[model samples]
Target: RVGEGVRGKVAVREGNGGRVLMMLATWPTEVSGDVVQSVDTLLAGVRPLPEPSVAVRATPRAPEPEPGDPR
Candidate 1:
């Protein structure tokens, strides 16, 4: 239990490579509407963006002419 207003139970177990996996399967608690609102506000519209495009070069550009030289 985190506090008087919130009570939760978490189950943690070891996975492959000694990694811990925590599961909050059952967390029945009594919280005010304000608490729920605050949590929603904190994670409002949270999402993952698509990966960016990457440019590839197969050749170098030609050198530019000098200021006083002809093209």
Candidate 2:
């Protein structure tokens, strides 16, 4: 009963601290189940990863002044 020319009902109700909207309709049996399951987890999950490791890379110490190289 929710297609073209279909008439819907509405009302105002007091919620915990505010007004809440409620919509009622007869949906396809299959669709009703999927909608009730919730969409909070519709997409994939995720988690944090440790920061990448880093090291201070210095020039190869200038070949270390060859042992007998003249000054």
Best by lDDT: 1
Q: Once superposed on the true structure, which residue ranges of model 1 sit more than 4 Å away at CA?
A: 25-71
State the lDDT of candidate 2 residue by residue for 1-71, as single tens digits. Answer: 45664433333334433545443433344454455343222211222333344443343445567789875
In candidate 1, how many Å is residue 16 off?
Answer: 1.0
Give the Cα error of residue 27 in candidate 1, in Å.
Answer: 4.3
Q: Candidate 1 on 13-66: residue-level lDDT in tens?
A: 554445555554222367566665555554443333443444432455689998
Clashing residue pairs found in predicted model 2 = none
Please give each candidate's TM-score.
0.31, 0.22
Badly placed stretches (over 4 Å) of model 2 are 1-4, 24-71
TM-score of 2: 0.22
Q: Pick the candidate with the highest TM-score.
A: 1
Model 2: ten consecutive residues of lowest lDDT:
39-48
Clashes of each: 0, 0
